[model samples]
Every structure is written in structure tokens, then in C-alpha cells.
Target: MYSFLENSTDIHIHCCPHINKRSTDIFEVIKFAEKNKMYAIGLMDNFSNTSGYASLVKKNFPNLNLKIFGGLIMEPPAGGVSYENAKISLEYSYFENDGAKFISFPTHHTRYIAIQEKRKLDYIQACFYVPDSGPTNETTKILELIANKNVVLNTGHLSPKETLTLVKAAKSLGVKKILVPSNNFNKTTIEKLKIHNVYFEFSYFFVSKATEVPLTHIDDESHKIKGLTLKTLKDLIEAADPKNVILSSDCGVSILPKPHLGFYQFIKQVHELGFTIEEIDYMIKTNSKRLFRI
Candidate 1:
């Protein structure tokens, strides 16, 4: 287990057999988490309904040795979330839904550069429903459902302007939690999301490229510790209380390094970039405890 992660427990990661991943089993993930000294791990996978062998591991392995939780990758917005739509979201098992929508929260300056420079419009569309849900009755119904439970309202793919509007609406409705994961990252989006006091998810994907890596740059050095790196992450911390930031591995891809190294390497690099250990700990631990309600 990585000693670095022991200090900053991680609560978000994708570990599923349904997908062709290098680290495709619970044993591997758990061992890595422990070996790396990562405090914990949370499971989430796109189009999956269970952690496959995770339950078996949990049943056989649940203990103080390490911590593990389940999560899901939700549908992209195709239309505004109505009550019916929100109900659908709630129906997903933690393995595939977690009531967290995979989308961008804003549309202005934040992600425009990434979109224009890297986002594949056609590929992204095929993967998710864009302009999926507009603000309408569907939106109200969805918000109301989330407001009633410990659901997480994530502005996954929306842009800056869209993020502001969507986050404000979700907050007003009293959704239990709000998240702006990787897809919602950008200067303007982070700036706007910080205003709502929502939790922001950070991952090692930004540090190293991997399959389906949504975070890529013009070159290797650009995504390095400096430059446009985790600007959104830093901004989120500066904008909100440190306890509002959360951490994730976003690992399990075939080409990326094992999650253990990914988690530690992320810290090593970010620290080299000037983030303090306490700040990092909050992003990986305290912040997620409140956001995921674990």
C-alpha cells in the first residue's frame, strides 16, 4: 500500500470486469489500495450494475484493513431531468449510477479550450446524450427526486454557464450533494462551481495519459505539474473550503499504471507543483466523506 494515500483516502474509482481494464478484479484493487496505503476505494463503472467480484471480496474481506465503497457512472444528459428521469437515476445500483450524472457543468471559457482542442464531438455524442436535458419540467422532477434523498447532483459535462445555472438549481432544490467531476473542469466552470460550495473530484488521469483519457494536452509538458494542469482543482480549493474537495483514481484502464502508483504519483507530482499535504488530504479524505455520505 502506498503510504502517501494512507493519509489521503480515495473514494472514487472505476473497477469493473465488464470493461477491458488492466486491473479488472477486486483483489487487485484492494491489494493495491492497501499496498499503496490508500485509505479506501469506491467503485463506479459505466454501463455496469455491480462490481462483479467486489461483493465477494467485501463479503470475504471487509475489515479495518482497508475501506471500499460502490458508485456508478450515470447517463449523460439528453433532456432536462424530470421526476421520471430522476427516478430512473435513483434506480441505478451504486455500481452503475450512484445518482451521479456524467456531464459538464458549464459551457463558457472553462472547457471551450479542451473541447475545441481535444473533445471529439462525434465520439462524445455517441457515448452520451448532449443537450440531453434542457431546463424544463423534466429538470424540476429530477431535482425534486434528488432533493429528497442522499443523492449526488453532479455537473459532469456541462460548461461554465450551464454549470452555474444547473448547480444553482440543484442547490436551491436541496439535493443532498453536488459534484463537478473531471468533465466539468475548466477555469470558468471551477470558478462558478466553487460559488456553490460543491465537492470537486480529482483524478490521476490528468497526470498521465491512458485509454479514453478525457484529459489530454497539446503535448507532454503542457499537462505536466505546471501549465493548465489541475487549474480547476486548485481553483476549486481556493474558491471553496478545503473540506469541499474530493479525490479519485479514475483508474482501471489497461494502459495506465496500476492505481496504487497512480494515486501516489499524483500526490508526488502535485506536491512538487506546490499543493500542501493538508490540502491534498482534504481532497482525498475529509471532503469526500461529506460528499459521498460515507
Candidate 2:
């Protein structure tokens, strides 16, 4: 294992039992994390809440050293941004064991992007969106729940404008930890969002060539997606303070490398790009520890 993998934390990763194909199952991911001496890993599934699965892992592996956490995504299949659903999901998490550490607003099914791309999926009966006015009553209630629980709030795949609005509202509501996916914002937006004290999550998948292909069976136009180069990722990092940045694999699709390998490669690439180990550790370990309160 590389020095960086020791005590490193990855807050974003996909696993099996997904609606789409994944390279590994949750158990495999957990085993790998433990063997690599990782600090923690968060499980993400777009169609359902993973809190229960994380609870199962914790129950079965009481002796393991690694921390395994799960979260909810506000897609149609996961109850679509309702306060009731969010509440139940948190309750299911059994937070004492590190379950439901995150509550992500919609990702691939974000209404803003779905409309922009003209995306149509059968399971997606509805898409989640926040109006220009701000979060709805239901959303406000969920935000309050998040603030109360003190879990991470990930701004998944929302349009940059919507993300900005959501972040402002979440901050005002006393939500301490907010996560924004890097692909959703540009340099200017990154600068703008960082000022609000929200962590920007940069995924290795975006820069890998494997992302040019469809990650799941339903994704047909992925080949048309433009992949971000290493230089661009470096530039994006420089756009914000290192303390506000997070590095995650965002890998698990069958088309991509396993999450751990991809994460190691990501760290290596960033280091080769002239980032000192201290700076890389700040993004990969220090900031992550702060976010997860490890």
C-alpha cells in the first residue's frame, strides 16, 4: 500500500446491488479498505438508501478497524426529496454506528441536468430541483433534519446556479457540513462556493478515460461526455483553498477500475502534477477527517 492510502478517507464510492453494474460489492470494498488500512469509506447508491446495508456491514464486522458509512440520495426511487423519506432514512442509519453520514440531493436524476440533457429514464418518474426562490418547505424541513443530525449534505449534480442557492440556504439553516461535486462547477463557481465554507468533492472518475464510456447499462451517451484532464483537475484544485477540497474515487462502475486502485492512481497523478504530499494529504486525508469528524 502507498503511504497516502494509510488513514485516507473516501466519502464517495459506488458499490453492488445497484440498478447498474458495479465492479465490486460492498463486502469486497470493505475488505479492501480494511486491508489497505483506510480510515473510512462511504457507500453511495442512486436508487436507494444505503444506511441499512452499512448497518449490516457494521453488525457483521464488529472487529474490523475501518469505518463504513452509508447515505441517501434524493432520486425518485429513493423517495425523491421528501422530508419523511429523509427522516426515515436517518432513523434507519442508527447513527451511533456511523450510518447515514450523508444526505445527497439528487445526482444523475437532478431535474436541472435532466432537462438540459433531455435525459429520459423509466424508473425516474420525477426529478428533484430547487426553485430559483430557494428550497421548498419539504426541502427546508430536510435541511433542518440534516442540521440537527449534523451529517454531510452533498449537492449532487444540481446546476451551478441551483447549487449556489442550495448552499446559501443550507448555511443559513445551520447545516455545518456541505459537499459539492466538482463536475457541477467551474473555476469561478468553485471560488464562489468555497467562500461559504462548503467542501468541494473532486472525483478521480471525471479525469479518467474510462468515464468516456457508459458507466451503467442505461447510460448510452457517456461516450459523448468530455473527460477532464489532469491539468484541469489541478487548475480546479488551485481555484479553492486546499482545506475546502476533498478527493474521492467516485469509481465502482464495471467500466472503471476498482475504487481503491482508482483512488491510488488519482493521488499519484495529483502528486506528479507538482502537488506536495502534504498538499495531497490535506485534500485526501485532512479535509476528509474534518468532514467526517474522524
Candidate 3:
């Protein structure tokens, strides 16, 4: 209630340089992030397919002086949300069969796949199969890529098998920083993922307001809210190593009065539920930097 969201550092945010969502200008978003004491912001655009926006931030607000890490949300032949689609997007290098199986990320009608936690793999596979057959040896692709430390093989859309297999592949490959940043509803298997270097990313608004966002819905037919709930957050923190966990606002839906406000509330609630300050610090400061190589 007293704003535990203070001194927040958002590891992920898609802003003006990347997406012209127009909900708030990049300048204004930066101002808000600074006012909120957000230490680092990852500037990603689902389009443009490059980190070019990072340079724009440096050009405009050199004075603000934030780290401003840049990345793109890659899509496979299956889909593209933020221009993260590239043949090499999943592959680190052509020398080995390395890369990620982005699968079904951006939805058919909307932008990303919506799956019940139990059915995420089915949903993702359906997407990966879209416009073409899925990869033959996706596991090898994940392993070879993350093993080298040059790429972060995120589990975009796929089943639990994808998440688990990717983690194992990443581990076998030498990936120390794996991120399971699927839609919040994806039931992140903490133990299975923890065997490999990975952290589960829970979104802010999706958990708080289940019905509004496509990925966060809990309807039994299409998507089940599943892991996108308060108890899931608590359980993950309790069951897993805090250092291997991360939090994100998502802040995608247009209903927000202010961006990151709902995320602010989500993190605050997590803290109030007895998650250690040290753990929060690890997720907010250390983990993301280590994973993204920022």
C-alpha cells in the first residue's frame, strides 16, 4: 500500500524507439521510469528487427543517463510481434545448428498465442506449424545456440516440453541465462527450468486483470489464467532460487491510466507477501543484466 514499487528497475519495456504505440511518448515514458527510480529499461520493438532504437535514446536523452538496453522481440516464420523475426534471430551462428524455436508468439488474429498453462505447448506448436511445418530438431537448435552464450533462446510459444527441452539444450549448450518469458499463463516449471539456467517472467496486468489481455485470460475453453495469479508468484518465489527469478510489467494493454502502474502494483503485492528484499533486488538488478548481458 505504501508503494513497494519504489526503486524499481524494469528489465523489459517496448518504447518509442521501437514501437510507436503512442500510449506515451518515449520521452514521457523515460520521465516516468526515472521518476519511479527505474534503474534500467530494455527498449525493445516488435518491429524494425534491430536494436536501432537504443541509439535514438542515447541521441535524445544523453542527459537522462540510463543504461537503455536494446533488443527485439523476434518471431520465426511463424509470427512477428516486434520485428524479432530473422533466420539468424534464433541462430547465434551458422557454424552449428543453434537458435530458438520462436513458435507461435504473435497470435493469428491478435499478436501472440493464448494457451492454458497446460496447453501452452500445443498452442505454441500450432503457431510454429503455421505457414509451414515446425522445426525438425528444435531441441538441438536450442541447445547449440544457448550453449555458446551468444544468444538467449527464449521460449516464445511451445509446450512445457519446449520450455524444458530448451532449458536442457541451453544447459547442454552452455547458456547460463535462459529466460522463460512466455505469456503469463504458461505454467513455468520452476524445477525443470531451474535445472537449466532460466527464469520465469510474470507479467503485471495479466495477473492483476485476467480477462482483459488475450494471453492472461482464464476461460476454460481457450486460455486458462493458470500461473498468472498471485499464488503462482508466491509459489515460484518460495520454490525456486530468487536469483533465478524475474518480474516484468508487460504494460501492453491500452487500459492503463499510466504505463507500468499495474506492474508497480504487482511487484508491490509480491513484496508485501513476504518475498525477501534481497530476492527482489536480485531479480530487478542482477538477474536481468546477467541474462541479457547488459
Best by TM-score: 2
Model 1 residue 249 lDDT score: 69
Q: TM-score of model 1 relative to the true fold?
A: 0.71
List clash counts for every candidate, in order.
Answer: 32, 0, 19
lDDT of 1 by residue, 1-294 (tens): 434677456655655663243555667788877776665677664444233334445567657467665533333322222355345545443344343322222222124343544445664343322232545555556666667765666665455565567777777787658877643355556666776777776677654565234432212312222223455556645655456666666666666666776776777765665678777677777867666565
Please, what is the TM-score per model?
0.71, 0.92, 0.70
In candidate 3, position 254 carries an lDDT of 47
| Candidate 2: 10-residue stretch with minimal lDDT | 217-226
Model 2 misses residue 194 by how many Å? 1.4
Off by over 4 Å in 2: 94-98, 120-125, 217-226
Error of 1 at 98 (Å): 10
lDDT of 3 by residue, 96-148 (tens): 43233222233222213433334555554644422212333654453454455
Assess the local accuracy of residue 172 in candidate 2 as a C-alpha lDDT between 0 and 100.
97
